[model samples]
Target: MPVSVLLVEDDEVIRRSVALALERYGYGVTTAEDGLTGLELFREGRYDLLLLDVMLPGLDGIGLCRRIRETSTDPVLMMSARGDALDVVSGLEAGADDYVVKPVDTSVLVARIRSLLRRTTFRPDPAPDPPPDTAPDGPAPLVFGDLSIDTGGLEVFRAGRPVALAPTELRLLLEFAAHPGIVLERQTLLRNVWDYGWDGDSRVVDLCVQRLRKKIGAERIETVRGFGYKLRR
Candidate 1:
């Protein structure tokens, strides 16, 4: 089936143009003119991804994103006319997986959408059963002081309880877990985790780290002054 998308924008021109572009790219697009209507559509239909404009009447993108996060972990991408630092930070905090600055470039927007969708489709093959009295086959969950990451299952546990993590957050944690105690540069993370090329913003990495810390414990991830971030050993 064609990848389904829910596009929510208050601007008539932007909404129509974006919907058309995605359709041409072979996506099944559903457009909403306001945040409230967008929320209603989301609750009623199943979509592979969500595209939201920051400034919307009734609910606004940040609020709408938060409401969606309360029950769903679907990939969300936001667009901001200002594209200021504050707007980006707010959207990420509200559980948006990625954002695009306004005057939207169709190519870049599609690339971001594709990247987010790739993560959603990724699934590590389940390991064959382990030999008796030995560890399970394939990739086992990485264990930290109080956290556990099951890369194959794509689930995280804290103190033996499942942690509710968005797809992006889980991917970030997996990256950190893969290289425990090693400081990961922002640019490297952007490339490896977000699929950004050379030119990418570091704020996305920083905000995602902050959100990961909140779920896994702030002390679990260390900020390395001018360097980068590292997972505690």
Candidate 2:
């Protein structure tokens, strides 16, 4: 089945052009003129990804992204004419999985979409286990207040209750829990958790951490100033 994409841009020219390009690339495309209509269409349809414009006529893209994040985990790629760092950060903070500046090359946009989708979809195979607890010598399970990370089952529980987590969030939390109290740098975290060769951007870590904090409690993870983050013990 073709990957479905929802395009929400007020610029008719850009919207139609991008939609056409996406369709040509074997993707199902749905276009909306503004955020409100786009969100409505999104609610009524099933799409694998969302292409959102930062500026819109009604309910701006940032607000729309926040609302969508409230109920959906579908990947979002934000676009803006303003190519400022603040704009990108704002979009990511609003729950966008990625951001792109305007005057976007269709080829580059498609490639970014592919990369974001790939990262969101990849799942590492389960690690091999040691033979039946014969004098286990590994680290103990990470325990922070009521939260516990079970490496064996790849599960997280708070007060014995399971907390629902997105795949990306789960992987991130697992990496942090594996090394409790260690302030992992953004570059190291990006390389280890996402398996990216370079540091890329740190916003990915920030956004994931925000989501993780919300799910696991704000105080569950401590941020080290100018460094990175550490799992609270």
Candidate 3:
């Protein structure tokens, strides 16, 4: 099935143009002019991805993204005419998997959408040997402090309780857990976790780390001054 997208933009011109472009690329595009209607549509139908404009009527993109996060971990891509650091950071902090400045090329928009979707299906590499002895079938969980990461099952547990994480956050944690005690550069994280190669934004990595820390315990992942971030083993 073609990937489905929910695009919420208040600008008629941009909404129509983007919807048309996405359709041309064989996507199942659904367009809404405002945030409330978008939310309604979202609640009514399932989508592979979401493309939300930051500024919207009724409810803004940030608010909408937060609402969605309450119930779903599906990939969300935020678009905004405001490209300032504050605006971009706000979107990411609101649980957006990715952000794109408005007036964006349709090709680039499609690429970003594909990247987010790709992450939804991502699985971590085979886990390390199951904590000495206690043998089990399949890949074993990687334990860090009180946190347990079942890479094969793609589940995270904190102190024996499950932790709900968005795909981006889970992937980031997996990368850090895979390389415990080693500082992972922002660029390296962007490539491995976000699949952003060179066209990457470090703030995305930074904000995601912040969110992941909140769930898995802030002290578990340490900031390495100018180097990068490392998982506390």
RMSD, each candidate, Å?
1.8, 3.9, 2.8
lDDT per residue as tens, model 1, 1-233: 99999999999998999999999999999999999999999999999999999999999999999999999999999999999988999999998999999987898889899999987676776578788999655585799988988787788899999999988888888888889999999998998889886668899999989989999999999999888999999
Q: What local lDDT score does residue 55 receive in model 3, on the 0 to 100 scale? A: 94
Q: Pick the candidate with the highest TM-score.
A: 1
Worst 10 residues of 3 by lDDT: 123-132
In candidate 1, clashing pairs total: 0
- lDDT string for model 2 (50-109, tens) is 999999989889999999988887888899898788788888888787777899999879
Find the 10 residues in a row with the least total lDDT in model 2. 133-142
Candidates' C-alpha lDDT = 0.91, 0.84, 0.91
Per-candidate TM equals 0.94, 0.80, 0.94
What does candidate 2 score in Cα RMSD to the true structure?
A: 3.9
Displacement of the residue 52 alpha carbon in candidate 3, Å? 0.4
lDDT for 206 (candidate 2): 89
Residue 115, model 3: Cα distance from true site in angstroms = 1.2
Which lDDT value does model 2 have at 10?
Answer: 97
